[model samples]
Target: MRLEELMNEHYDEFNENDLHILKYVLNHKATSSQMSINQLAEACHTSRSSVHRLTKKLNFAGYSEFKVFLKWESQPAEQESRHTEILTNDIEATMKNLADTNFELLSNKLVSARRIFIYGSGTAQLTCATEAQRLFAVVNTFVTIIHDQVEFETMFPSMSDEDIIIIVSLSGDTPALLPQARKLNAKGIEFISITNLKNNKLAQLSPAAIYVTSSPTATEKGAGLASFIPFHIAIETLIRHFAEYLNV
Candidate 1:
């Protein structure tokens, strides 16, 4: 995973000091990568132990690995004109997967469930889920959207085996969602997932999953612009297939 991904996965665990240190490192990647742990702590106006703890929270083996990661991220990106072409290929592949996927089980579950709830791990993912809700509503299959953590927690206890959940997540390994996934699993609740990658925790926990392939275009500074267009395509495909299944 990239630094941004790591951060996203463990973001809820970070404190204000950790964020401050992260901001400093992000802004001074080249310089910080070469600094010793003590040096970085001094520069960030924090203690060495605090810096080490932050590295661990990011899932780095140690400060050494963290430094290596910083060094890797600081390297200049190579320009690729084929980025657009690659994304097109990725979308085509995702569409093929969608067509080939057997959605019968999911369709049955959706049709039989007493209630259908949908949630997303982030803002963009929530937008995709909203689109899905809109599509389902077209068929009069009213789906509930869990807008945030507070709502999710409040509504979770009311969930039963007769209900089904749809989770939209980019990484599928988001920290905030893992506990909920585990709890859902323990309760034998049925849930499906839509994520960028298939081999992630959320997908593993799900009885059904839709995987979308997305390639991030790298900027000169090594930051990436990952297109979520494939997510929308997958959503539309699933909803259309379900609509056909409903013979609507």
Candidate 2:
């Protein structure tokens, strides 16, 4: 099951804060897997105890044990071994970390939403939104991508408990969208966030998060290539999961 699906399966048991922490972990696990408990707490703006509690809630022995599982789960299979090798360099490492995190997030959740709404801003925003739209379509699912804030609100009233909203951002800190995300949270809307940073404000707001780790764009020519690869891999995984769900 995907992270969303997992959440849906256990939705009634999750409190708001629990959902928030889950989102942060799912979004940033790729990078978080590399961090210590202290670092994870600092990134997520929570306490070490909170992190431990979350791990326990997820039925793990602790953070360290969780990381081990994450590492094992992230390895590529034989067929994709060659492709995985291509990512052996620094860029590959960053992207592989992201892909691993995304896989965990998708596999853990069990979302049964009737509809999904995707939101993105700036130039690449539409691209990300379209990618999600395309992937979700394979499972005969419904999705709406919104570019402007005005249009988003117009459709907000129509959103029900069965609907989901997904937001994508590299910084995990988009000024215009932050307030809106908070507002939606206040309204009890469930959200899945895809972002580059782990503990950023957006991740904090989302109920579930998919974190991508990529090299710095300004530092190297191909630095950001691995960053976007995680998103592509995530969408592909989501599509497969959705297809499996439909078949079942």
Candidate 3:
């Protein structure tokens, strides 16, 4: 069975703390794979014993074995190599990736969010705004894509526990967004980050994050080549999921 299937099967066994650890593990398995049990405990704000118990409850022999399973589940499959290549060079391929990722993001968001705020900067900011507007039209959901630091700051005071923030940054290292993200966390607002850099500050701050592989760094005077296909894919996936949730 798939990891998700297994998780569902054992969902009833998890308590609030267990669920918190599980959510973090699921969203961050790619980086969690590299972490030791102690490191994971530190990241999750839990104890090593809790981590061990959770892994055993999930039917893994121990933390190392669990990490291996998580690694397999989190990384892109070998088949994605072809799609990645297409994203780099072919418009058609890029469009397909966008559609797929968007569907996934929308579905997950629809299930998870009460209210949603999207934060982005540079080209990504435009993408978030467009998606937020599109989703607001379909569902009676609140979706805001904040651009400037002042605008972003002004809105946070009104957020409550039921709100979630979806932050988009290609580099996963936007310093300006960190304060807002940290503030949201302190206020019990959850986050979903769309970024290319794995295990960066943005990912560390976010309770859940999606990483998309990107091309190598650009040369001086050349257009920065961090691919936006993954971001588009995630947003499109999210919108479709949101529509389905409304229908249901």
Q: Write one digit per residue (lDDT tens) for candidate 2, span 1-248.
A: 23433343355566666777777767765676777889878887878888787667666789898777655544544443233444444344444545545544543343566677888865576687898788777666768898888988888888876777888787777798898888788777788877764446777677776665543433234333334665565556566765675673
Global local distance difference test of model 2? 0.66
Runs of candidate 3 exceeding 4 Å displacement? 1-114, 140-142, 217-222
lDDT for predicted candidate 1 compared with the true structure:
0.84
Instruction: Indicate which candidate wins on TM-score.
Output: 1
Worst 10 contiguous positions by lDDT, candidate 3: 93-102
- Give stretches of model 1 more than 4 Å off: 1-80
Error of 3 at 80 (Å): 14
Candidate 3 accuracy as lDDT: 0.69
Off by over 4 Å in 2: 1-111, 219-227
Give me candidate 3's TM-score against the actual structure: 0.57
In model 2, the Cα lDDT at residue 42 comes to 84
Q: What TM-score does each of the candidates earn?
A: 0.66, 0.58, 0.57
